[model samples]
Target chain A: MSNKVLPLLMMPEGKEGKVSRINADRGLLRRLIEMGFTENVSVKIIRSVKGSLIVGVNGCRYILSKDIAMKIMVTFW
Target chain B: MTNNSIRVALAGNPNVGKTTIFNALTGAKQHVGNWPGVTVEKKTGSKKYNGYEIQFVDLPGTYSLTAYSIDEVIARDYIVEEKPDVVVHIVDATNLERNLYLTTQLMELGARIVIALNMSDLAENRGDKIDTKKMEKFLEIPVVKTVATKGIGIDQLLDTVIKEAKKGPHHEHMIGYGDDIEEKINQMENILEGDITLSKKYPSRWLSVKLLEGDDEALKKIEGSPVLDQVKNILSTINKEEYEAVMADKRYEAIDVIVPQVASRHDEKMTASDMIDRVFTHKYFGIPIFFALMWAAFELTFTFSVPFMDILDSAFAWLAGALADNVKPDWFGSLLGDGIVGGVGFVLVFIPPIFILFLLLAILEDSGYLARAAFIMDRLMTKIGLHGRSFVPMLMGFGCNVPAIMATRTIEDKNDRLTTILVNPFMSCGARLPVYVLFAGAFFGRQAGTVIFSIYVLGIVAAILTAKLLRSTLLKGDPAPFIMELPPYRVPTAKAATIHMWQRGSMYLKKAGTVILLGAIMIWTLATFPWGVEYGSEDSYAGKLGKVLEPLVAPLGFDWRIAVALLFGFVAKEIVIGALGVLYGLGEDAEEANISDSVEADPKIFALNSLGLMVFTLLYMPCIATVGIIKKETGSWKWMLFAIAYGIILAWTAAFLIFQVGSGLGYD
Candidate 1:
């Protein structure tokens, strides 16, 4: 277990990361996991906007806002 | 084959070709209605295959059976209560990892499961191979390959469904939630085993798991139960969120093990969809690109349909004229010509532009770009106290407000749904597009498109402002967080797009025949009565009615005829044009004539007055059908009446300001 986890929103565009943890409300966390943000899943930042990020996780494209992205902690590859 | 019947439910995530499979199964035998209590759409179809009646229900697309949203609740409750004979879980083969998450929940519910490996061709095209046999062995469910769009393997899917329906419910597919949580669930199930009533109503094991997960809807259901206190006492001892997370993780762990064994994936390559998303959803380029595309859609909608509109206009005019000249009795001629032909013909003439607008919209929707439009617009929509999902409904309002209001059902947050519904009518629908074209054509002449476009922009601005006002006042809440999947763009098929276009367009034509036709005839009857005086003269019923309301609208520079048309527009916005045709004695052929000339002949309708009228039309009450749905959706007359009253005040104030300011600036 690496201690190098950071919020996914802070990861630079085009960088790949593995989801390590999620710090969000129960409902949002459940939604995020069902959307394939589960722990140990590989996620790549396809695009990052000012307050949102488009991430590719498990062959699906999701547009997640800053608040949602910040809650998803990941370790950069 | 015996005369046996099978009830099957289709469940899947959005964009997983569930609808296509439903269409493939049922073909033309499908019907859509609301779920028993909620407004979420319920689609059901029946087919006779092999001498058996197979009824299919398309459950709302949801990621999980958790009751986080209304759609999820409906899907969950239907499966739990209705107890469908078999639930065919449709999984997108290309995106198996995410789609299978829903499958885990369906399995937990103890449903008789048959997995339809939809879009297998797409997976193969992307250079991935899915071994259905290994997958079936792992999940203990029958797997059937299906390409629903092309109808390949559909018969095999149905045959599998029939076979699966005969097998009783199975609960062997449960994901192990480790030891501590599993212990608690067993304890809760043991306690529930004492209560005969609760066990009969629900799967006791599933209930205990959900109870440990702190599902609010599940907790609420056990309120009056004798075992509720014991259930709560047990639930209070466990940490809910941690257990829920562990449960979710275990499900994913199961999928993680199963996915690799069943399918081998090549390292994901950047595909064309990624390239398109790179530019289309680029932070700096997205907004401008979205607006540019919308502008092109509007331009195409208007310009492409002009010649067709002219053809319709002339054809209807000829019909009216031929009837009026050839009819035996003069009164019958007027009734047939002016009353029916003039009223209904005026409403029908605008069908071309409205139909084209819907066609273009259907293409955008089916091509999957509409979701991206919502994504891009989300940033701006949030400023006005809404999220991306609200934008879809507002965009649909451009077609017609009825379906748009219904579209708000997709917005999970109640306040968001209400605000979206309240502001939807402000998004200048195609019905109102003709009114703008008529006025802008009559007044602004050479710059008609620009004027019409400006009116549309103003509608958007009004909707935004109304949303802002609603958020700050009655429906007070911060904008809900926006999270949505952007499906890869697919080349929209002409057949699917045409079916969608005609499906929506037919609603407009239906409104023309029912609501609009009745309104037109009613207005014609009002204008033609007291049967002796010159038709449409001030002494006629409609004329007198307009004159009585004239003082109320005079401050906005509207004349009696304009006032009367606005009144009739309450029925349906298209009726505004039709009412104007009737009011000025221009007959059914008003659109074919230079309607601009007759409007210009009226001393009261100048450039400024027409501008005022357009602004007024943009903000005023939604049509009768829209108001009815608003009442029905909100389930409250208070909100419905409030919507109507506020729209009137808003319309008057906006129009008055424009007319007054324009006059002071010497524009008129």
Candidate 2:
């Protein structure tokens, strides 16, 4: 399945939680690794203001532009 | 004396949370300003701890110490000349190997070094362990783990810094290289050591390595000194071109050794970020995803802002009526109700839409996706001969043109900077948001969202076409190659993101009080007239001015009243709405009428007219402040005037065509 439609963060209350493993192709995998995304690292959904999800990776948070986030596949672990 | 305060400098790569850590340590004591004679920001702060006044200077973030850019030059100069009490080198723990490359360079600078292993929480969570003790032992500096965001390990980090500051420079520590390169470095260092001045400040071995790397800044620094000629003679003997290749090889060799010992990783399974990036960065899907997100942003801007805008409009109208009822004289009431309140109120109604627009933009920026958008759009940007780096500033233009033009500092090439600055005004700025919202809301109903979205797209297209034309003719040059480090994907902090949004939104509010206020008052005076006759009447002063210019804009179907609105728009575009409000004798309260209904009832206010106005706004001469900034940045009044004249001519021609063709299609 295409990873773009994956629901990566399951924020029932929209609080911080551990990030789930992603299922996608090799090219995406390599790019993510380069961007400091790896398995077992906790990701926090800080806020979903204006339909864009602001997630914190490691300790530093980056607002993920909405367009890029729609493609990452995941389910709340 | 122990009473003497020590100066410490914090340096790191961009997006490493260095600023957060700086704010955490210093709190309210910090002062922020630009570096001397340069636009790069400088931050300095001090805190008293354990009887020692620890002064901290936050140098601009840079990837390396090589003077390839202004920030790097500033960082290197501060360290080498000022000789800080201790240099705290902050590195991202998650990307230890890449971060340490800078660490090796810092050590070579011969300063008292302390490595802050920031973001330890993430490192621990990822199942990757960094043995701080081993790292300290191998690198020969104190290693302190810190999560700057949560204020973790900060005290310990400060304590280590204090201890290191007392010890002064670490002369014994040197990053080792292999025999071949080491032999070359030793020969050069020895040759330069005898020149007394060369050995006084800089480390000989570090100077030798930099000389070999063909760093021009370093070459210039050591130039004119007798020792430089000797170094040059040695370089010529060794073949200068090959010297750089050999030094690069040496850097890699050192990296090869330092990375494995100080860093270890657990091979993790595929993470969600990786999986998501795959399809998002895909050749076919990425562009479509970008369009979809932008579409959502447009939809939200129009749909969500309506209710708030309506409430604000009503509140202002009610206030205007109450003032009109209580005021004594007729002219006084007109000035209060029609002039001040009407003009300012017309512009004030757009606050809701501007706020919503900023919120959406902040969300996008805070999220790490904006960079990826730039990454995806790079090819298209290149095809039009504009650097992808131009995207960030242009994106910023959507917030405000002033800062967007200021952001041109990041674009290194002069020609690229000029082109980006010239075309930036075409991007639908926050000021123009109200004009579009007011017109589109009045004319299109629910379709207003799509209408606003199409206007933004139109602005972008005009900007691209203008950039291409300028490049081919006036600003001819090959666009600089696009190269940028894509930061890791993380959720942005609510505190930071909100602060960013408010800061941008507040600028608009401030402008309303200052420039827009003066503009509205002036427009009111022009529309007010000779003797007691309202200036808006066909026989008044404003009428004469508008009639004289009306023929010029007649092709776009604008009457004298519309011509007056366009005239005021040149002073500040927000006044376009206010000028229209006053001209129509719509007391401050009258502007609250449903715009969509008014446009529908009067077919003359066609979609074509709206489209033409949007195009004209996108292409017209920028607001007064932008013109001042253009003069300052370009340092020439000739170019500034050229920008103004060219913009107005282009705007008129484009608006004329859009209206003529669109009306031909029976859009009215």
Candidate 3:
């Protein structure tokens, strides 16, 4: 495990990481948590192209635009 | 059997085939109306099985019971206040972990739960094995595997629901919220116990847990309670968001403990869905593929439905002629032949194209492609300063703008919702589609399909440009965050698709039977009055009104006749073509071909005027119902009037420009 944290958009394709923090407005953060993006939740980037990432979280795939992905900070383990 | 009458609710995350199960259970016994105040649909259906009468309420599909969205608030209130006998929780089998979050919340509410593991076949096809028996044991709930599309295991699910309902109320189905939160929850529950009014209104334990999590809806419910100040003081001691996050995490922890015991997967495999996404959502190819598919749909909607439309037109025309010839009184004959038959028949002929378009859209929506469309188009939507969630409502506008305006309630941002609602009418609903097809067929001839497709494209372009303009000028702000689930693509079932298509298509028929029927008779009465003047002639009332409006539209190359049709069009877009039918003196017995010939013979309407007319039709003030809804949804007569005024001004200017520019290029 590394202490380094980066925005979810920076995570390379096919890499798995855990959400460390959500740097967004209260409304968006609440929504992110509701969608299974809680802190320490493991997320695997299934595909990343053109700034949007298709990530696998909690056994479900979610297509996140760069705007949302950028607000999510994660740590790779 | 005690002849028990049970009330059940079907609840789940969106896109989990929950609606399919509801449809299967209720069949044709469903009645859909709006929720009391909100525009969200309330669906209730009943079924009698083996001496038991079961009434099922279909709750809105929600991600969680949080107060973040209207759907969530509505669903939460329904379960808390209505207290259904049994809640059949539908979960996507392949996505158990995330779906279980809702399941955990339901458990906290002490809901008597039966889990319908929907899409089991899809999960198995993805090489994920789900042990329902193990799942049932782990969660202390009945689990029934169901393939909703194929209608498998539905009876067993219902039987389990009936059994659960018969067992009175659930007493103990709580999920542990770890030590720290459990301590706080207990404290809150103790405080809540003193407030008998609150306890009687809500399940005390659930209220306590939600209050600790700082749930707004729950807090609002207990606002006047004696324990409110105490609970607020306690909640202030801890960070509200952190508590919410922690509670959510604890729920996930419960699911994490159950997952390994009940399910296994052979690694992560690239599914056929992923393969399709690779191409369809490709960075460069995605937009082109989307437009190409839209073009194909437009072509099919126009080309394939032509023969059916012709048959209907001929049948109605023959009936009108028979009535005109056989009836005794000429005015009575004219009322049957010209007023009723002409008005209704003229609009009814457009049904095939409307039905085909809705059917194609339903297929696209059910097969999961529409979500992908939204996902891929998010960038462009954000560029226009609108949320991607606005896309679905705009798509619905293609069916009708009234519902589309109401659908904007899903948009969380106020500015985004207002802007989306204002621009929704420009999406060229099916009611407007017939005007395009009629004009394009009359003038464009061999290129009618292309002309019609281009009109749709023009509509999209206008909607986008208007949105950008509104964003820059009136509705200023960034769009809400775009987060959407790209559901797995499944083959849309014919039964489900047909049912959806029929439901939407029938709305059009219902409108025709009621509103359009009245409009036609009114127009007929006006056109045929002052008995000496020929019907729809310049001396008649409708004709005189058209003459008055003719000067306003003349610059756009339209005459009094088209101007009068435009006036009638404000009532309903579909009536534009019908109005034109009456104004052209084609009568009810004229086929589509005859109407086209009539328009073709009129020198006042040529290629340029037709183009201008189509543009005006596309951009003009939305039909009356849309205006009413805009007022209702925006809660302002000011914005509604603004929408109407701006649309009319924009339509006139754009049509004038198109006509003037095209005439200079000598298009006619």
lDDT of 1 at B402: 86
- lDDT for each of the candidates? 0.82, 0.72, 0.83
Error of 1 at B457 (Å): 2.2
lDDT of 1 by residue, B1-668 (tens): 13489999999999888877888898778787889876677999999999789999999999887867888888988887788889989999988988988998888787898899998987898888999999998888899999887888889988888888777665554688888988898999888877888777778888888889888888987878888888989988989888888888888898989999999875556767889988998888998887777777777777777777767766666676666567868667766666666667766877887788788888888778988877787778777788767888888888888878987876767898899999998988878877776667667756777777778778888888989889988999886666788887888766667767777777778877887777777877788888887677788898899999999999999988888899989988888887775565455344445333454577777889888899899889988889999999998999999889989999999999999999999999
Clashes per candidate, residues 3 or more apart or on different chains = 0, 19, 0
Judged by DockQ cut-offs, is candidate 1 incorrect, acceptable, medium or high? medium
Is candidate 1 or 2 superior in DockQ? 1
Candidate whose lDDT is highest: 3
Q: Which DockQ value does candidate 2 get?
A: 0.03
lDDT for B39 (candidate 3): 87
List where candidate 3 sits over 4 angstroms from the true fold: A1-4, B1-3, B195-197, B224-239, B585-601
Provide the TM-score, chain A, model 1: 0.90
TM-score of chain A of each: 0.90, 0.58, 0.92
Docking verdict class for candidate 2:
incorrect
Estimate, for each residue in B1-668, the C-alpha lDDT of model 3 and write its tens digit: 23599999889998899889998999978888988988898889999887789999999999888877888888878888888889999999988877988998888777789999999998897788899888888888999999999999999988998888888887565588888888888888889889888787788888888887778888899878888899888988998878887777778788878988899944545778778888888888888998888888888888888888778766666666666567868777776776677678878888999999999988988888877777677778878988666777887888888888887877777898899998898898988888877778777877887888788788878888999999999889988667778888889999889888887888889988988888778788778887868877889998899889989998899988788888988998878877765565455444434444555678888888888899899999989999999999999999999989989999999999988898898887
